[model samples]
Target: MDEMTWLDYLPVLGQGAWVTVQLTVWSTLFGALLAFAAGLGKLARNAAVRGLSVAYIEIFRGTSLLVQLFWLYFALPLVGQAIGINLRLPPVTAGILALSLNIGAYGAEVVRGAVQAVTRQQYEAARALNFTPRQTLFRIALPQAIPEMMPPFDNLAIQNLKDTALVSLISLADLAMRAEQLRNYTQDSTTIYTLVLLMYFGMALVLTAFMRGLSSMVGRWRPAQR
Candidate 1:
């Protein structure tokens, strides 16, 4: 085979990059949702709700993300078969699920910490105003806590983006997988890996900028709630 040039490699890699972007976007969105749910649940007055939230956070945080991906993509189907159910998920679906769940567990701790850091005086003031628990949380606590959460959440978002590379192991055809395929065919390890690294860095920069802008917006909004 003739040696492939950068021109030929780029388009194929671009396709793979698109897939990676999609996975990152979906996983981050879902993970944020899960983080809030689990975080708030942990703070709930109800014991059962708190226990379940703690269990979910612990299970995901304590385990390896790679193992989580493998179990979701491989073991789940067999477990389903034993129960006469189809628990198999598509590679992309499985990838997103594992990534979101893992990141969510970590983000939950960030959420919990930020919320807890809100001063006791704030809660007392809310109570003085005859605010209900739900009203105080949404109106007072979250408005303060959410801004604090953004920096850590930004880190988690970037980490989630990098973690999406692991999906290539499950044949998801992400950027890493495409780069690996190209390397196997061309044996151009240095060039191929370098391009992949640069591409990931570029994506990370973009994600970071977006997250910072979001954080700024939240910071501005927090004062308005006062």
Candidate 2:
């Protein structure tokens, strides 16, 4: 094999970075949905709903993300066959699902905590106005509680970006996977790995900045919007 310059690897890595970005964006959006749903479900008045939400949160949070990825990518297929169903997911899908579920579990707690932190007086005021529970939660409580969720949501967003590296192990051709491929071909382990590390750091910094902006916007929310 011929020796190649770092510039030659950029194109390859860029492609991988694009995939990583896509994974992060899609997973974060979907995961936020799950987080909100599970979080609110935990606060639901019905015993069954609360139990289901608690189970999902505990199961995902308690397990290793790596293990969760492996189960989805590897074990689920076999389990599906045993049940006469198709459980095989493409690497991309599995990666996105696992990352979302894992992060959503943690995000659920952040949501729960933020919502619970809302003052009881707000609810009481809603009650005095004869507002239903749903209206009170949707209007009076969430407009305030959502701001509190921003800081922690930012943290989780960054964490999810880093977690994308694990997806490369499942052969998703993300930045880390591209680095490994280059290192194997060129045998330039140090330079290749260093570049990969820098790429990840750069992505993380960008994500953090974006989340900070979002948090600032959220912070500016007025009760008048409610």
Candidate 3:
């Protein structure tokens, strides 16, 4: 058989790359929302509530994501059947669920740290001004903590995006899966994996660039002194 040119696999990579982007982007955005809630829960006044959040974070963070993907793809069907829900999660949906849960666990710690970074002085000032806890949080603390947390949050985003490749293990048509398929037919495993590596690098570089640009813009804005 003639060795096919790299052009033959571009379409496959393109399709796979799109799926990877969708998985990473939506999961990160919505997962961050979930994490914000979970993270706040980790700091809840109720000991039980905080404990639940902490346990959830530790469980997900401690496990391998590939295992989570397999469990979601395979084991959940049995549980779903027992509960009478649909006994299946499609690849993309499973990817979203697994990715969301994983990222949410990590993001919880980020949010907790960011929230705590707000100085006591700021909280005291807000209280003196008669701001409610929620108001002080939304109006005074969140904005201040955002910049401090941005670095960690940005790192997480890049990490999650790269991690999306793991979804391919569950038969997701992601970039890595496409690369593997190309390798199967062409037997040029070296080149295929190399391309996959570069593809992920390219996407991460784009994300890193965006974060750096946003940091510069926010830095230039420099909030006005009270």
Best by TM-score: 1
lDDT (tens digit, per residue) of candidate 1 on 1-226 = 9979877899989999999999999999999999999999999999999999999999999999999999999999999999999999999899999999999999999999999999999999999999999999999999999999999999999999999999999999999999999999999888888999999999999999999899989899555542
Clashes of 2: 0
Per residue, candidate 3 scores C-alpha lDDT tens digits across 66-129 of: 8888899999999999999986999889999989999889999998998998899999999999
Query: Considering only N, C-alpha and C atoms within 3 Å, which residue pairs clash in candidate 1?
Result: none
| Over 4 Å off, model 1 | 221-226
Could you give me the TM-score of model 1 versus the true structure? 0.97
Answer with 1 or 2, whichever has the higher TM-score.
Answer: 1
Tens digits of per-residue lDDT for model 2, 66-146: 999999999999999999999999999999999999999999999899999999998999999999999999988888888
Model 3 weakest 10-residue run by lDDT: 217-226
Model 2: residue 35 alpha-carbon error in angstroms? 0.5
lDDT for 50 in candidate 1 is: 100
Deviation from native of the Cα of residue 125 in model 3, angstroms? 0.2
Which sequence of candidate numbers ranks them by TM-score, best first?
A: 1, 2, 3
Error of 1 at 183 (Å): 0.8
Off by over 4 Å in 3: 216-226
